[model samples]
Target chain A: MWDKRSDMIVHEQDPFNAEPTPQVLAESDITPVDAFYSRNHGPIPAITADDWRLDVSGRVERPHVFNLDEIRQRFTTHAVTATLQCAGNRRAGLIDVRPIPGEDPWGSGAVSTAEWRGARLADILDAVGAEDDPDLHVAFTGPDVSEVATPPQPYGSSIDIAKARSGEVLLAWGMNCQPLPRIHGGPVRIVVPGYIGARSVKWVTAITVIDAPTDNYFQASAYRILAPDADPGAAGPGDGISLSTLPLNCDVLTHSDGDRVPAGPVTVGGYAQPGNGRRIERVDVSTDGGTTWNQAELDLPYGPWAWCRWTHTLCARPGPLSLVIRAFDDTATTQPETPAAVWNPKGYLNNSWPRMTLHVT
Target chain B: MWDKRSDMIVHEQDPFNAEPTPQVLAESDITPVDAFYSRNHGPIPAITADDWRLDVSGRVERPHVFNLDEIRQRFTTHAVTATLQCAGNRRAGLIDVRPIPGEDPWGSGAVSTAEWRGARLADILDAVGAEDDPDLHVAFTGPDVSEVATPPQPYGSSIDIAKARSGEVLLAWGMNCQPLPRIHGGPVRIVVPGYIGARSVKWVTAITVIDAPTDNYFQASAYRILAPDADPGAAGPGDGISLSTLPLNCDVLTHSDGDRVPAGPVTVGGYAQPGNGRRIERVDVSTDGGTTWNQAELDLPYGPWAWCRWTHTLCARPGPLSLVIRAFDDTATTQPETPAAVWNPKGYLNNSWPRMTLHVT
Candidate 1:
């Protein structure tokens, strides 16, 4: 596994958390399979496509079990090109503001886009005779157990039924038109576009339709945004805002922090993703510490759920320079100017203005 | 009309644009029909229910005309309690930052919630055999014509077919359980809950399914967000972002700009709205210019599309004091801190932190 992802930046060894370099992501529209980010809460479970089984139960009228072949044969296949982002993407900025111990110090590489193909969760719900109730939730649980919880338990998360039945959510088994790899949930996983990546359970084994959000630690307590001073250790279930869809975010991917560049015309670019179905309307690049701004050209997104790649050519002078990028979604919502404005104890959803300093020669 | 709305703060007399007092809005969840804000573009059309006709055509399998009685009898009636907000609801804040000529300086009272009873647009689209295409748009036109456009054309706008068939869009005929008043689009109107209020065309005369967004000035250019320095005079059709789903916003509604208050303990409250289907997660009240914040208690919204009422008690000293409020939607998005951060030439979507100063004695 280490040899295969040698080109990526490995953050942890046991759970195999790794991400591709920023230039690798900036170079392509659809992220390459090996270069795609891998974020796991537990050791990768060993399971073959033929031996994997999916149990659909709970409020569903016809509770049934299906092998991998049955899932592929019974439901119609649909493809969606969506960008999945970890809620902790760009968490390094928050950690720099203050100490966020025990959290991954992500640095703008935990997000990537891919062409996902699979059976729609809505179709599966329809096959199982699921009722259309907004109050209900579709919970997904995986076989991999992680000690991240106080007591070891299978990793689980859930999305509201309306999102589950939106027809865009999928139980995907293929990535970039290739068979899903073992490291990325080979048999099957849930792909909830527009939501934070944690909700898209990898190695998904059992799906249950419940009346409320799943009581799993990830769904009920862990991935929430608490007050800045609130102690996460003392929080109970549903303590803070349960993060779902993402907010407008953009990052400068070409130049790493403290990079030295020749003082002349240089290209600066990055990727921007607007939450839910909103489109990236405009991207403003500020070379003079946000006192002056130039609009960057945005490439049309592959789909509503995909990210837009933006580029701009800036004329640099001989000295130190500050570069900041912010995006406005179609809804006219822009990002906060600094990470401190959005910093939390968990260091999640750091959608502040992405900045980098370049020493010009 | 003025007699009926004596309690409202009338902005325009001819087209009858007016809004209620903020205290009036804060006092109730469901705005009384008489106190509801009335925003109009042109002179109200005098059409009785018996003679009013709805012509449904354009890109549909069947084109038909329906009378009010036919509309009431042919489809199932649904009730949705939704907040309708003007894109210019908080334009006053932007205007205070800079001069925004030729625009109404609206305060925070331009948004209100009411229970609307109507036929679902999805049902209407189904009845007309409209295809479910994401690229297509459903255009709506009304008999009232506004002179705001250079050519003085009838007010018109369009929403994408996905939003049109989302089951939340309605052809509303009732407001707060009463027959819609003439000034408020008497016989029938298109009620797009989550969109900018301009898209909800009143006195609706025609509904057309089109291949692209409507060419009407409102849809094509007027409601768009242009660059700060971009000359509006030189802008063409399809320029800037066409305003649609609202951004997350909150407003302090209990006191006016210069109200004097007793020192010691005072209660401050406001309304917060999360865009589209998202709910208001948390509201923060700052008594000393955002340096410190106290979480305001949020009241349950009437529906997903409704606004959440929030309030907080503050201890004040005898001096001039500034209060600022910001809201976090379930998506973890918050308002910008200052009006200058979001000021545009058009003075739309000033969702910056809502602030007011008072002389505490």
Candidate 2:
């Protein structure tokens, strides 16, 4: 649907716009959704699930619309598997001494983990009836449109109404278990798994509900994060802040010292999360960085919003060292011991403290 | 060069192994070597720089070989940019179950950042001649060959000769500044920029100087790291631990809580490094994980093998949160707050403490 004279050109390498290309997981716990990673923002629209539908409408009192098998036989499906990460994934490690605009330079594969399924935006906002308004604010909208004139803000995002009635916000359709690929977001989309995939909107097509929260343009101009001194082009529109649900950060995104196994064995795996409703309860690791610490080994427990997997092991003797890891949750919270005091400037939410640097003989 | 009759049907959706694709860094500061994100292990070998050369040879007395323009006009080039990562950059966040076993399920794009350039393996081991037995060791080799077998010890990896005479290693031949790409390792490679890009050996060819380490198969059976409690399919090769440099990790890929700017103003950014000689310095950030910490904002000055970029800002408000970041070096050392203390099983070096989650609307 983008042939406005064939220039096309999306090729920004297109791993959905960022950093992936690492491969090697053959048969290791399902991540095959066409290799996931499609952080789309354009091109992928081509819809047709019998002309989709959804709709719902503002201040709902019953402003319904459904379609798509009447919202999949009027709700009740559910499934999870979590992991979605992409608040700009690894924005190429942002530094910008000068050049700093935006749009995918991601180096962490944006993040993926599937298994989704559908229904349950708290039962489709209780079948389009929701409207007790505690300051409402649901807003989704996607079927993607906009050819400039200030496009770049139709992707939409908004949440709050107690996390949209917190039934774990769904409306997905399927992923990992199939069905849902119109560049991901397919016949129905909006999983919000562990949040941040631009609020999981994809082809959504209206939800509204807002009473006073969405000034549109991606909630009043671009998913933001300014103010370590603010001045994102002189901030404007309600002037920033709308990244919907996520906080309790944890990111190690790979660190390795392995492959020596003779100093009496070693192990040290990673991945941890705690952005929404925080969870991750433990991951310590230290190969001399904390002096002495070592607990890692968690894996399997997911959903307080997903992402967890830890591991550790030690025994030394080789040369050049320094390996560290840290994490804790369930609310005791922890992690943060450097990055010179949390620098900032729209690089938003940089959780620090995880180091690796090895050289064993 | 694959075409032995050309049937070529590996295809598992082949983005190699796919999933975890998050690119989007138009530019915040470099990271654009074709958007950098590769992590190969084979396939992508098509050398021809007038039939490359290199050589050098053992306990040297002049076993010279050079070529590549006499190792680029008899040495002295230098460059840096650093940040090579990939110790399984975020191995699918460490797979919570049934995932973990030999390489490449990287979600964090296995890390990238370029700039490189060459000349200086301690100035070609001081013009081919160092081995007064400072415990020998040196090694290197690599025209890459090994589909298994060759065990009488002969692959390679060894460093101590006073860290190969310091001079920051090199032999690169550009990247980020261009040239060098035969899927990386072009007509000349070997940066060791900060160590651990598998010791920066690509197409290299030979360097030797040994007296001890060279059990090849990537230093005695694949760059090791087992024994957290061992048992990665019954751990072998003496049971693990042998990567050469890169530990002092810290990753918090990305976390969002911004939208233009308002609600106190927020910002957070990522990337840190310390492996091999170590040096990060500081990075703290905590939206409420470490209870209350905040220091992030480092960038530039990098040299313990490059990769620094940090940022932080906070004050937003509107529910759910968690954001943590930690990093240290210059000796304060740090990071180690969980991951079961540091479990092990060849998952090697897992730096901990970098949680990120946000939901501030």
Candidate 3:
């Protein structure tokens, strides 16, 4: 018999499982929540508030445990609306060349912006009496676990010693003015605003200061983006890089090929975010290849972790047109010219310029 | 500690839980999956195929029970890709005038599309032997038990004898070319292609043909959308009307105040779906309120149960502009002119002309 719990409301499509096909972003600067793509590894957990707790241990001078109420009351809270893009957000575009092995073959839904509020991790570290140890990596673990045949380390990741101490990291307790729901990490969870979400562990169970990087499976094996030149099928974990922060470049693509719009004028828009406190200085759109470029309108100012929306209007001409958009950060890091040049085995961190073929009739 | 399953991916938003605040649907076609919205009452369940079954009983000439394997072997399979929209898909737009009791405050994500496949319910009914009864209602029961203080009726819904006999209903065993995932009613389920998804029961365990309509809570009280003139908050078991078939109407509204586009050109877009067997005959859009209208381009052919994507382009001109899109069905039933005249207490069906304010520079 179908379980009542499984009596789910069905929609027109598998809303969560579809691959991201390139489409122009809405004209508005802030993406409506439904339009934001989702990136998840499994089903949303059903968490009960009564059973939740946050444990703080390891290299701390005072190891203490806090429930949801205590964590909310003992710390000063702040909010920041930032864009959280999965390191592998647009992996499908790369997979079109060759299949990549791993979890979600996500399209673009992996990126989204939400107002986050919580105690800064740096503040919590200070409260716990952290020591200045160069070798220490602040490791965060979640209640979520996956079985490994080889007794794999628990699924968890860590931030570098400096970033953890920057006082910018937050132990988020709320979103959009509401207590965080269990689906999005309820009670208390970590929010490293400018970093990839992998390090922002949900359902956080513990914070441990270790002398070395986390040995967890999620730390050592997964969440690592292979180098651009790495072999597709070769596996040795060679020089694979762990994604500790967001990428510096922004890649936005639009598709109008089969879309029918009258010939005269058209507007295309999307959002871009840079990693490591880098702000987007400008966005350029090219109707042809990069041979020619035009400045697009920046819809909003750069926020600490939020993506900036950009738009451009093009006079319609009757013909097949190629649309390309690339953004540069204040640090001068621009999106790579093409995906082929930056294609990697795991299809991670694909910040290549997005190319769209459209008919502007 | 967090359950390992907590990491299960959340692919989309609950559409009815919020409103169209910043206006996400651009061009009215292509509902982004993450933004496509959802309406579910409980946490997704964990179901295993080995323990699943589909039972057929009641007023049949030959009552029979089929396990997952037996159901798979006994029926010839077919597939259909259709759109399933919840009755409450756009209820948020109506909350300002009159509020409904106990219903979820959903925004716009309650609709989605997917390819569904299974043996025809007609075939199964014929296999088990259909009695020569003309007034029987086919009842479907699922395995979920309610936890509310009120004793839960076994979750079930019914279709009319004519609908059951029409040979269009299906006992869906697959979705999008894959075995139905447990969360989506794995081993076997139902697919009432042109009907509301709530009628397409998941985790189906039994099917019974009774002389009277289903007495289950869902069929008796839950799914009905009261008439616009009905009293607000009057939907109780005694006062509530049974939710049978959905009305054939389309409602698509825009949230922006008048904003002008450059005088060269502009594009108009929105989504349209006929409630039942009704096919969308034509979609007309107007840049000047209801004064003048232009025919729009329809994307795909009308399926027995799916939404069509429609778009139109307007020659831009300088003025305060209001864009309204209306749909005509095979039956020639058009959407209401305004929400106020069609608003209902239960907020069931609110298919009115979608109006968007825009300006042409």
Which runs in model 2 stand beyond 4 Å of their true positions? A1-187, A190-199, A206-361, B1-66, B70-80, B83-116, B119-189, B192-198, B201-204, B207-235, B238-282, B285-297, B300-305, B309-361
lDDT of 1 by residue, B156-216 (tens): 9999999999988999999889888777787899999989999989989999999999999
Give the DockQ (2 decimals) of all models.
0.50, 0.03, 0.01
lDDT of 1: 0.88
Q: Which stretches of candidate 1 lie over 4 Å from their true place?
A: A4-8, A48-51, A60-65, A69-79, A117-119, A122-135, A165-167, A177-179, B4-10, B48-51, B60-64, B69-78, B118-136
TM-score of each: 0.92, 0.34, 0.46
What tens digits encode model 2's per-residue C-alpha lDDT throughout A1-361?
2211122123253223433332321123345665556666555677788988888877767888888887888677888777777666544444332234655445445566777888888777877788786778788888675332154455667777777777777888787777876777788888876567777888898888877666666656556654345656666665534555444444443443332333545554656776665576666666676645566777775465657766666665676557777665542334554433333455544455556566666
What are the clash counts of all predictions, listed in order?
Answer: 0, 149, 36
Which 10 consecutive residues of model 1 chain B have the lowest summed lDDT? Answer: B1-10
Better of 1 and 2 by TM-score: 1
Better of 2 and 3 by TM-score: 3
Interface root mean square deviation for model 3, in Å? 27.7
Order of candidates by lDDT, top first? Answer: 1, 3, 2
- Name the best candidate (by lDDT): 1
Report the C-alpha lDDT of model 1 over A235-341, residue by residue, as the tens digit.
Answer: 88889889888888999888888899998998999989988877898998887766556789999999898999999998889998899888999888888788877
lDDT of 3 by residue, B144-230 (tens): 654321346556788877788765677887776778765556667777866766787778899998888787767766666443344
Local lDDT at B353 for model 2: 66
